[model samples]
Target chain A: MTSGPADAGEAMGSAARAPTGGMPPSRDRGAPTEKGTATPPPGTGQAAVGAPVITDVAGLQTVIDTLAGQGYTVIGPTRRGSAIVLAEIGGTQDLPQGCGDSQDAGTYRVTDRRDEAFFGFAATPQSWKAFLFPSRELLWSGAAAPGRLTVTPDPAPGKPMAFLGVRSCDLHAIYIQDRVLLGRAYTDPRYAARRADAFIIAVGCSDPSSTCFCVSMGTGPAPSAGFDLSLTELLRDGRHRFVARAGSERGAAVLACLTAPTAGPDDLSAAQAVTDTAAAHMGRHLDTRGIRDLLYASADHPRWDDAASRCLSCTNCTLVCPTCFCASLETVPDLTGEHLTRQRVWDSCFTSGHSHLSAGSVHGTTRSRYRQWLTHKLASWVDQFGTSGCVGCGRCITWCPAAIDITQEAAALRVPAPHDPAPGGEPA
Target chain B: MRKLAVWKFASCDGCQLTLLNCEDDLLPLTDQVEIAYFPQATRAVAAGPYDLSLVDGSITTPADAERIRQVRAVSRRLVSIGACATAGGIQALRNFSDIGDFSSAVYARPEYIDTLATSTPVAAHVPVDFELNGCPIDKDQLLTVITAFLRDSKPDIPSHSVCVECKQRGTVCVMVADGIPCMGPVTHAGCGAICPSYGRGCYSCFGPQDTLNTRSLAGRFAFLGMPEPAVARTFRTFYAAAPPFATESSMHSGGGR
Candidate 1:
């Protein structure tokens, strides 16, 4: 419990490297994206369990460089267009410094945080899922001859990835995805291959956007588990530093290579205070208590019709959700007449086509499709995956063109409409 | 080889040019289909009863209406290609106003111009086997249609919204993050979401999707500060005659020209 699991260091299979200054002149921006060391998580980043080490701004830069130098493609949150999106970052120079965001249903705008803290923004539009489970990827390619068809399965993508500034909700979303993809029934080798080589450096959420409800979900203002490292950026009186914790030995190894010192009591308290404030200021909240039962009980409720009236059925909600993993395979024959390829592309339940079978869609109306998505996400997903599909990151709400807040919609389902005879009456 | 004929009505021949754009790919395709009567590609003209006809525009004139029937009579499978052939194109804007007024505004002599009072899709006049959607239909999709026909299979053109393609291509939603009024929610998937990828809102060169709530999307556009007339006009463009879009636009079009 004290500095993670006792066997974590042994699990790393290698001793830590001597500390480096990680200063300029040695800063290589050209270090391509890749990953190296892997350490299994002991799932401990709690103050009650273990104390975290605090480091200065230069230390943040060191972490980036060291990760990059170790052949990891360091993906970090940065200002892209009007939102902070994850992209390949070589160093701290690529971080979203002095930039925060204001988010509401169907709205997001990058704001001047008016301070020089990296990772000041809320959750990004595109999650880490985009990298781990891409929207489109080649499944296989084949060439057909007169009597033979030579098929070639796609190779796992090259280069391991190190994600910088991953959120606590996003980390949970990743785990949920792992359960779905790497569960007992079947394993997606492509997803497994990508996930095995990936490193997570989760940043604690000290600022939740107007659409955020991670507090209500109890996922965090700070990560409890499932990270190589957890970083809580603290900008105190003329002091900008991070209270960093190693969730796994690989994270500890990365920290050992940086010129970081063990944190004093003051730094740990300061870090705690940041998360404490964030926990209070959650802009949105969802009552998850019996949410699945509520949804299951409200199948005949007229609320779905109200939602369907506003829903564009554009697949934006599912696409933005990091946990909603549904894909469609398309067979593409080449102009060469001999070559053919099958590709896996992202699909959503919002589309009637997603339910297309028997030469017709089972869910014809928007009301039916909306009900399927809502119930499946909040209800059946728990039955199937043993967990609620929503991490309450509020991506679905923020990215929805109709400004349909899932939290508000979920709450509304509990209340009976005036026209309805009862909550669970005959279908409207 | 199967004979392929490219025909035109009131279009700018952009969709026909898309076939030419497939320079390298077209070479092998040429082996399967004979380019019998693509007047734009060659001075070549074949007699009646073509294997496949690619019609690229709306039926705007009296002569055009007659010609489309004759083309359908000859062609084995009639594929309506591009926005004009599918939804009456941008030229269909004249459908709203008096054709005399539009002719007077553009033509030196309004009396000299030969045009119908309304430009309507080829489907308005005759049965189309398949309709390829776009202002200038994507060459790849056009090829897919032609290739499918050559194999005697149904063309694999999706009737899904442009948002599906946008998300698949990993183009960040312009309407969501930027608060821009985008036509992507209702527009059919084609053009691979080119406009949003370029940081511009989709102008909906490809017609409306089969499954879309235009009324709901119109509400969103109005919320994004697009005036009722502007919202009406947005749906009216490129796909002016597509029923759902035209109906939605007509609801708001009374506010302005």
Candidate 2:
């Protein structure tokens, strides 16, 4: 199973590959690290690994232009009504410039950052999943005529995509989904095809919202790996620039086409400082120390009831969660009774039909449904995938009408269960 | 091919329009199921004993109550579409008041009018095989129900709240963030969370979910500074007569057992 461009080098050799050098390839940079290790390696400009380059606002625009010139659809965060959503961009003018967002539990508002920083926003309502695994897609078409049935599969993504302004948490989320859709026992052909052809332009988070907790999840504030090009926006004293590093040969080739200068020591330090500040300023934290065991042991905890009291069972947590990958099938037939089409759509665990059985839905109670979701995300996901399902992007918290916080719920599970006294025993 | 029938009672015909609005799939859907009894689409009407029936609207009149019973008896599988068929629609608000007063106020001659004291769901009059929740049911969901019935499979209509759709669409919660009182937690899904995505709270047009905790949501609305009357009024919207919502509204309004 191919994980990224690194694993599929021979297959993607036709495209630009990572240059061979003494410095380890970016794909190997997925090694897990602890807190306080967010700084980039020392040395600046051409001396540093992959030779980090410094580019101004125009240079970044040129990168967008270059990707467009290469026949790639450039997608970035832009203003859509009151929220900032990821959408197709024609040029740099389409990016969310001089804009940021304020996010809290069950609260989200687009605010002017009052600066010229382009990648100022944190997270959007839509993720890169919309491109790779669309909400709705036709699987195949079938036609039957006089005891003969013919089926034709749908074609894969036609145009390649250059996803810009992807945050570190979202980058990790993509990798997690990659493991589910591609690196699993059964590969999803559509997902694999889209992932192979798409180019990722990951941006480090310099402005985390109040709902963000990537630092605790060890997924963000700074990108570790799995990117074609990683960027860190540097805005100071009314001047804006970006520190760009090539993680692959394709990324280097694209950077080579730009007229940006090699990053100096000051630029590198400034970039490092940006990520460090973000890491320190994380708005939320999840102490994952034995979180799996804590949740499993607390299945009958009273906190589930408390959570259920406020819980709407709306499936919001699962839907916004980038790692939740449940789906349902839909079949439609033509009026002639000869033609039919099967489609796949996004499904949520909170839905009663998700766990439907012949007798009835397995998770009939709100408490049971909430328990199942939490247990799967924080505990059982480790058994299914080698990693946790949550990337701590905080979309679930901000999008929940009830403002339910998963981290808070998990933390609440840590509270010691009430002692059940023996019969006739005194109450504690 | 399976014979399908579409019936209506007391509604705006929005749910039927949703079916017609499936411009791309309408032709394909016609091929799968024979339109045995759809007045909105065709002039021809086929005899009953249909394989499936999609009934929209509510039983607001004594005549509608008997009509629904007849529709149920003639169909093998009957699925209710829209809030009207599932939870009595916006007209159900009259269930709390005297129908005599309503008839006298709205009609020129109360003696000529013939109406029921309350509006109720299809299930109240007949046994429904399935219920698709929405104000105007989502076309995709409606198609799924019909397809499932044709295949003799369980329909995949979710009984969860609207919060799921809002989260999937990445819509910021208007209730929690803006302090707007939203019924998304207690309301059913299928509108794809359109209101919240447009910066508005859910109006519960799809009706109450199967496992609705109306009392808890009512408490939250009150905690969010919604006045007692507003909290009661919130539950008395589209699906006001739905049991859970109805009970909660009455409890908060300090009236009725």
TM-scores for every predicted model: 0.91, 0.84
How much lDDT does each candidate structure score? 0.80, 0.77
Considering chain A alone, report the TM-score of candidate 1 relative to the true chain A. 0.87
Candidate number of the best DockQ: 1
Q: What fraction of the native alpha-carbon contacts across the interface, defined at 8 angstroms, is recovered by model 2?
A: 0.49
lDDT of 1 by residue, A6-64 (tens): 12121121222211111001111112111110111213334222357888878988988
Clash number for model 1?
A: 6
What docking grade does candidate 2 earn?
acceptable
Model 1 whole-model lDDT (C-alpha atoms): 0.80
**lDDT digits (tens) for residues B25-122 of candidate 1:** 98898888889998898996878689999999899999999999999999999999999999899988888789998889988988999889998999
In the range B1-257, model 2's lDDT, one tens digit per residue, is 78989998999999999999999989888878899999988889999899899998999888888889899999999999888998889998889889899889989999898889889999999999998888878988887777677667777566677876775565656775567788888887778888887788889888887767787777778767888888888888888888888888898754443
> Candidate 1's error at A183, in angstroms?
0.7
- Alpha-carbon runs more than 4 Å astray in model 2: A1-49, A420-428, B1-57, B60-81, B103-115, B137-185, B192-198, B211-225, B254-257
Give the range where candidate 1 chain B is weakest over 10 consecutive residues by summed lDDT.
B248-257
